[model samples]
Target chain A: MNGGTNRSRFSDLVDDRVDEGVFRVDRAIYTDKAVFEAEIERIFEGGWVFLCHESQVAKPGDYWATEIGRQPVFVMRQTDGSLGCFINACSHRGAVVTPLKQGNANVITCRFHGWVYDRGGRCVSIKNEEAGYAATERSGGRFDLRRIGALDSYKGFVFGSLSSDVPALRDHLAAAARWIDLLADQAQNGLEVVPGCSTYVVHGNWKLQAENSVDGYHVTTLHSVFAATTAQREARDATAGMGRTESGRIKGKVPSGTYDLGNGHMGLWAQHITPHVRPIYEARAWLEEKLKPAEVEWILNRGRNLYLFPNAMLMDNPSTQIRLVKPVSAALTEVTVYCIAPKGESKTARAARLRKFEDFYLTAGMATSDDAAALEAVQDGSLGPPSQWNDMTRGLSDLVAGPDRDARDLGFEPASSCPDWDHEGMFHGFYRAWLERLEKGSGVA
Target chain B: MSTNGIDPALEREVTALINREAMLLDRRRWEEWLDLYAEDAVYWVPAWATEEETTTDPETQLNLIYLKNRGRLEDRVFRIESRQSWASLPLDRTVHVIGNVLVESAEGDAVEATANCIVHVYGKKGAATRGSRYDFAFRRIDGALRIARKKVIFIDDRLEGPVDIYHL
Candidate 1:
């Protein structure tokens, strides 16, 4: 929480334009309180924060506890078939209303004070109806649960904003909507969360983790442990002579690029996970034989995700990609990872898919190791005597325009290219939106 | 899955053994902790369910971690000592309360036992929280029960976070 002259240093560190394709970021963005404050005010508050996907709350009364900015909120499906986001705290004494990870309930009753609220945020009953504030209006002013300023959904993905001035959810999503639609539309049988949450807390600035998810550059070296492992090395070696086809897992090209999608929306397209790396193809083959041909294709090629600014990110790998970056401080962040599956899939298929994701990408996977190294390493650099600056200018001066200016082409390389410079645009777009919100003010959402 | 005939003297000895093991882990008695396991003991915390099949390779089961013998586990210990294991910087202090001990079967030297345990794990800065629930089995070696197979299924295993490098 270091403030004062350090604030300006942080502002300077984060506030810079991309001129020749290089990105210059100041060191204080990670350490200074002022910059973090402004970021919470502007970026985290001013943009659409991904709450959870429709799959999570498909059934009435289903709820998921998530955070938007610094606020701990839970989104629930009302009995009337609508979605709402409200602070998780009880109105009486501010204790967490429903402490469980998730479950189905028509109402949330505070265990501390016995105050009860229905899914619609109406104060249904007080512990002692007669003794506590005689004849008090339960559904009025200070009694009813406070909901987020704006609650909306794009396709089945739910998002909330605390800021009054933020644009409509779709407008805020902008070009990123296309990707969301592509991912959401994959499940013709309809998607549902796979009964678990991948919650992990890291010891680093939240932004560092967000950038790492889409950066694609750190994959090679940071994940050298995996690359060196016998199993992973064999996976890579197995695909050595596969004709270098881009259409399968790596996508159309190696130099698949990234771009600014306006309103803090950005995409790092084509940086796909290798199917061969995990037994995804083998599992899909097993599933295809047992499932309809169309169902098999949809399950296999669920495109990757970029994020809709602030704290949410779309992973685009079969399940939901909503990532909420809750900053614990200048030094710590907890990321709640959620995955979704087609609601109508057989029990066998669901089990197989969940197993695949859990094995390779959950808390204990090679992916978590990459994240652990990147975040901890960044924490080391930021906490130590501040360096002049860190360079994010990997793929500068090579911005070749594709069908869309934001969608440029990366050159020939492994689909899992470490630090794909072209993907830096997504990282840049996020920071730009973040800078705008910080210059503004903060409010509770 | 059944607790048939329970032995009083044997139960007292087994409870003592479990308590002693818990103390060793909490006290970071690495060598004594290693000695508690049989030579061919297995320590497995599967990433997910083992596929239902008669023949499936344990090597390719996609386990969170599956240590075959004491040597491999010692290698993990060796890495912790030699390398910078950040998660263990302050070293997590643990309290494993093992209770509900039941002997399922007795076959020669091996005795199958099932127990309900609650392990509270405390990080360096805070009070402990529930760690996991274990379903353990023991085998007799030299007239004393040693850990034959340990399966610790964490309630929060599916969640992402630092894993326990040391045994729980």
Candidate 2:
């Protein structure tokens, strides 16, 4: 049958022949509609998807709209100041309840039928109640905006899952939280999203961006302009040698490496070359008093490009950005980048933070445009003629098992580590975790 | 009728300079584009705080594009000229259409002008169009007007993909 030929198994797609020093992914995964559908259903919706930061909904009645896979969802701060998440669909007629992307809402009135819901998402009133639902269904949870199956937060980062079958948020996060701590603990009151976000689309598979975040191999080629521009600026500003990966491979003499922090979360770590560019460095004295010696050093100098799998990547270098990837289709990905900073930082530090943010983080910025161009070029090239397997074997020689002295310093227990930053072997954990989920979702395991 | 008390000769000068900037951008005249701005120019594009609100301050707030001086703009041109700028490597083509120009006022040697703009760009990822409003601050230097400050407010801030200086 044609069905059997067309529907290839997930394992066949990701050929992981690690014993032979080979791991490759079929290019069809980037273009096939079926694979995209399965990913949205299994990976994005079925598991924990990051909602917004707790700071986004800090005040009571504050509402933030987002999506879980393709399903529209909204999160709000209840009157009692706790967080609540619900499907954006109105209970009455399925129209979007909160149309505003972000705002404060004392009551959510469905424009479709005038069904009124309070800040907590409970149906308080309805237009002509007697004309519609009976006494049993007029009020209570049944007629309110539907809540997600599960919602939880870890250190101010909120996550929601449409299926209750998922593990607890902390368990799911694991040692990835240690990396998150470097970002979270930087703040006095906690980190804030800084009020605006840069949203744009990429004409490539989401996985391309997912891979690029933790990849150091492409640095010398894809963004030489960044290095050149920074070099000129560094000469002007006399930026010190803290540790800039953009300057290319530092080799030995530095604590630079990569970690597969379990469950597909991966990162590339380095002590910064120009640490002065980072706002956190300006707050070093205050942070040292609040945190341990290791944390102070790790948080300020040895920064990282941390991916929380599936959706978010907390980039602590180039700029502190929370980059969220939403797959619009197999070929298109919507990206939203927000500058996150420790609350109530100095104006000088804040200004420097934003200038750095503008330098590389946005679509309009210098480096990202080149990245977008390169990523799109890769996508275009991958689509031509015959399908082939992509290699992920660059760093196989450098791959190490379990936590290292560097990882142990931060209480991080990654599945694997590579001392060299440019190696490609760290991506194995990401692919393995991805394949496992898809296999389980398709019942192929 | 559209001069708004501005000298008709000065109005023509402003129009010519604006068109010159657009032509240089589309032609990939990177150095020429840099020359059009004053040495201490400010270029800013603010980000939307919400659907209806945009953050007002660049110093203590967020911005889509913010460059305080000509050095940053020079860096932008330098990147594009580096030929390794993949986003701008092939040198994307942009057709900048400007209309409804109004000279708001003349404050001594400086002039405030506003215009409606649409920049159609064709790049590696295909075509992207941006509609925006440009608020410019110009000063007459050596008997010619140079852009001292330029603020571009996008009609739709939810850009679909990567954008750059030439795009708007």
Candidate 3:
């Protein structure tokens, strides 16, 4: 809100004391418009963003529309069956060139001025070319959509960045890439996002969603209703068919852990969850056959909610949901939700995945609704003299220096690890990454 | 196109049942609202897949809500009754306006009808207006009319915030 008039105060927003084990985030980061603008430029546009999966645009001419920060963009399967990401705006007047969320069109015509673009990022035709302009005005660059600086796909997950200063997509993912391999490598073929999406707004800052995505600690309390409903239903022997998986009674928190997969990526993982009812349960035998003993153990029974930082979450705890988080303002965020599954699975497993997806993931679902409500409450209360910081120093005593025993056994190393799954320590890493980005963007780093 | 020999009592009964549904929902009479539904009721709100079309199959496609049986509804009601459903519990003040009711047919002990509904929800979060098309199939069970299926087509596909059964 101050817009950096008080530079010293802005610098002190995050109170991260590693030696003292104290981490407190200034609440202004959630409600300040200035901070939100910085986030859009530095973290979003200046770094990598999760675009749609390869399966979403599998064939030539297939396209998907999305937003990187607040900029409208689209990804398409080029005529040669390669992927291309571009600004959705026309080169002429900046009108959105592709309007549909998903479609197949080899050539797209801007409805505003009749500028046509080919699948390969070429300006095929411009309206009234000879009469309207000389050779210079008709240059290819002026007529085509702006191409993304770097576009890459890691394990079927596509990412785009406008700024070339960031790390490569694989390095950016860091330890989280192995975590994604857990989902992507589930089936012999890769994963595919189920058709159709649910886009809904949450009245809260995007960081609230970022924090909430990997915060396992809040599930027992915040989604008590979901747990209770599932508990009561199981107790009554009514949780049978109609897409309900065997996610047995979600009672108290089980033995779980958290991962600080550096570069702001993190995860909340629990073992011995209802593995029998998980949709992937059907493919467990094949997974064991294909993966190592430790990997199979981790992949089969463990429940995970992995955060890719800034913009996305891949969850498989209650069910499988791919969340694309977009910040609209300090107090508003939009989320695009989808059910993702192995590329080719049995009919029963596919049905169970979709059903479980419907059960507790969407805005209309039992769990996320509560999450949205709680987040709104957090945003509504993000202010004033009584409190300057959000206390985030949970489970510090249990934090291991680097890659705990389980992580080491799995052949992956995280920046840090925690025995307790619900610990808020992962957020400390998130805030650090966030601070670094904002400082670098503002030229203070 | 023509109402030739449509029973006046049937009209009154269907109209009363629909009106009572609105009144009970607005009054937070969840248990009574449950009574209006058959145990095997299919309460569905399909999600739009494209600009002009909704995803057709709930079994394989995405849906805003697709509770196939009354038990799922009961789970929602149970959660709301727990006073822990903060999403819509501590419940919103809702005024449901239902109109344009038309009876499509009457076959044996079943009746089919369609209507339009708009719910004005006011709460601490703010106010939201939800408009939808309600397709209902009512069946006579033990001398009382009960909803066998209720499909709601929401007017606004892009939901602004958390939406619950109360909102729809």
| Lowest lDDT 10-residue stretch of candidate 3 chain A | A1-10
For all the candidates, what are their Cα RMSDs to the real structure?
7.4, 2.8, 2.4
Model 2 TM-score (B-chain only): 0.93
Question: Scored by CA lDDT, what does every candidate get?
Answer: 0.60, 0.81, 0.82
Q: After aligning candidate 2 to the native by TM-score, how far in Å is the CA of A397 from where it should be?
A: 2.2
- The digit string of per-residue lDDT tens for model 2 on A1-445 reads 1122255487887879878988888777787778888889889988887888998888999998999998899999988878999999988778898969888889989888788999878899989887766877764578878788889998999999888788889888877999888888888777888877778888999998989888876766776668778778767656553322234332223457888888888888876665665677778788889999888888877768998878999998866889999999989998988989888888877787887788777888877777777788778777743746788887787788998788888788999888877787778898898888887783211
Give residue B79's error in model 2 in angstroms: 0.9
The DockQ scores of all candidates, in the order shown, are 0.17, 0.75, 0.71
Report the error of model 3 at residue A169, Å: 0.7
What TM-score would chain B receive for each of the candidates shown? 0.79, 0.93, 0.93
lDDT of 1: 0.60
Q: After the best TM-score superposition of candidate 2, give how far the Cα of residue A63 lies from its true spot, in angstroms.
A: 0.7
Against the true structure, candidate 2 has what lDDT?
Answer: 0.81
Identify the runs in model 2 with alpha carbons over 4 angstroms from their true place.
Answer: A1-5, A234-254, A442-445, B1-3
CA displacement after TM-score superposition, residue B120 of candidate 1 (Å): 10
Sorted by lDDT (best first), the order is 3, 2, 1
